[model samples]
Target: MAGYRPAVLVGRWGEEAQLQEERVRDFMRRRERGELLIQKIKSLQESLLQKTELSVCKDGCVHFGDTVLLLNPAPAEPGPGACGSLALAVPLEDSSAYSAAPLRAPCGVSAVQGVDPVGRNTFHVLSVDGTAVDEPIRFGQKFGLGTTGGFSAQMFYLASDHKSFLRFATKSHLQQVFLTEERSYLTCWKAAFWDPQLRLEHEGFPVPANSKIIITHCHTNRSLAVPRNFWTRSYFGKEYEVVCHTYLDSHKAEEDKNCWEIVTGDPSNRDGSMCDRPDPQPGGVRKELCEEA
Candidate 1:
């Protein structure tokens, strides 16, 4: 039987300072107050865990439990690349530890650092004395104790029902893209590359309508991508030869007219996908594009 190796990983990121300290005090106070406080904490935990979902995964990735998988290189050559699997587990969760009580949900003390639903996955919070044991929750035993403190609780997760899968396109790669903008939303990556250039050649990409493409020079960490075209101004345009324009300049709010135009060569075409549309001197800085590295 394929068995699962017990691994633990923490997901505490972007937590504030004061809140962390306060949560620590709360846990310590409860622990010192004996059974009454402990029971209260357990009740709270139960309520939350009942509302939260759990999941599990066999794939060795940076999952809630598994930190990362170590891949080994093959000797000289073989099959595709060369590989094996090494399982790694990191610290579960961290927070301000108090002398009175061990912080249970320390990682969830803040708005940003709290426990988040990783969609649908099997996740179980097992009671750890020294090793991993899968015991059912009951009265007496410290089995599946939830971190939230509802009754005696344990942490657990399950694979999400909304699983994501990958798909390959029939085309070899992507080159030129089409963008459309409307009143409420925007669009990007409407079209795929028919013929790619030297830079975009063989570069395959997911054609999510209005896919954002990051354009950058050599340095800088800013990124900018045009949204897909829809109905802008009174004019219907293909792709913005430029970006960042006010919609009020064209026509009436409900007027269905194509007021502005930005034309450029299709890069995948035997021609260059360079923007040849007239400069936006009279319109706006809708063209000279820049993005993050």
Candidate 2:
């Protein structure tokens, strides 16, 4: 993990404020444009489906642009239902044919703080426990939880001060209750990271096209590289680290390690094995592994 340095607002207070405002306006303009491109891409996808005479199921199908199809077997399917896989559809003669159009803000919708133009939702900074968290959600700034917990949970508010940061509650610190005010930044090493790249193939959204973003917190001072391990808790409360070799062969393990490194800055163990590391904190015993890292 590497530290993120925020852009400083230089000059006198008034001048700095004006500069910040301009930066925010520019960001909103770009975001609006991105949203419009996404919309056009979605429309193109629907057109492709219609032309191919293939109807996307309300469930169990994933669409990407206008040429990809990921299928997940329904539970009622014969044999193992979990063995869904990816398949390509409608290859284009020119890849550039699927290029998305530039986006424009919807008519009558002003770029306002705290509102998502595409989703039509108000921005709110929320705590892990669902309470409204207050902080200046400024553009190019990072906000972190100020606690003594081992997990790193922070959010970077990109391009706008009005959009709310949403924090999905996690059962990371089950032993203690986090005070609303004690939320600070976090820095940690040795965590599990799961990439469900194909899990959401069959889903529908209110918005024709959607994007999901995940945020990770790291130290603002130092960069750390650590190996990740998977762990499981037994019925008697003991925890055991899961070695990848036990389940995946050498070739798959190496491929997975490479992909994991690409997705997460952390590298897999040199031995190509997943193992547990001893905790330095007093009385801190490994109880469970995080599903998402």
Candidate 3:
């Protein structure tokens, strides 16, 4: 055999080792970059905390990481933008409860169930993200408002001086309602219904056992549906000549026996003069007091 063959060097092994080393180096660099970004964000948040007056609110208007509240009488439904169907209110005062924190209300149904202001004559917390104002927002304070229907309305602050809140008026605040050229009507009457539980009767209304009558919104025009949960405890005489109607089943017709005969195909021609006054109850009938007939 000839003298030992010259040793041959294959560079494949060396190349693979270099490639693995490069990958390890790249991974370390990326991790360091992520750490730097996290630190920068932390710094920015700390800086903002020093400037915002949101830390001074003590009346529950400013809660950190909690949903605030808004009060509006509009019916709940899906709509455009951050509020969805719920309303919005700006905070006016800084109290100890809201002091030293940032506030946020997440979008979607959380905005409704978690943040919406619901109740009558109570203070409502409105969460916000920004610098707090100088004084506590209270009754008579004014806020700029915009609506989805291109309608601009004023949101007056009617809350008590004790705490931050949005006030809902039990009395009518509408000075006048200007309708279009369409025929409209406003009628008031007592609501009647049967209640197995009879809870509503305790609240108000005269209900006989096994009777299936209840207050509901009904429209004469086939194309339109009645507003949801429409009820008014206050009843007054007809001021406008707009016409609307309500229907009574055979059972309800038998309750009064004589008052149920007032229906016509066109609700406008029906005799509302015979419509009885609304019963004195806490929450009265399913009456259409303000609507376009």
Please give, for residues 165-200, the per-residue lDDT of candidate 3 as tens digits.
332111222111111211212111122333325434
- TM-score per prediction, in order, is 0.14, 0.16, 0.20
Judged by TM-score relative to the true structure, which candidate is superior, 1 or 2?
A: 2
Q: Can you tell me which runs of candidate 1 are displaced by over 4 Å?
A: 1-29, 32-90, 93-202, 207-293
Q: Model 3: residues >4 Å from true position, as ranges?
A: 1-11, 35-134, 139-293
Compare the candidates by TM-score and give the number of the best one: 3
* Candidate order by decreasing lDDT: 3, 2, 1
| Model 2, C-alpha of 51: deviation from truth (Å) | 43
Clash pairs detected, candidate 2: 61-201, 61-202, 62-201, 114-162, 145-183, 145-184, 145-185, 146-182, 146-183, 146-184
Error of 3 at 12 (Å): 2.5
* Deviation from native of the Cα of residue 19 in model 1, angstroms: 32
TM-score of 1: 0.14
lDDT of 2 at 78: 29
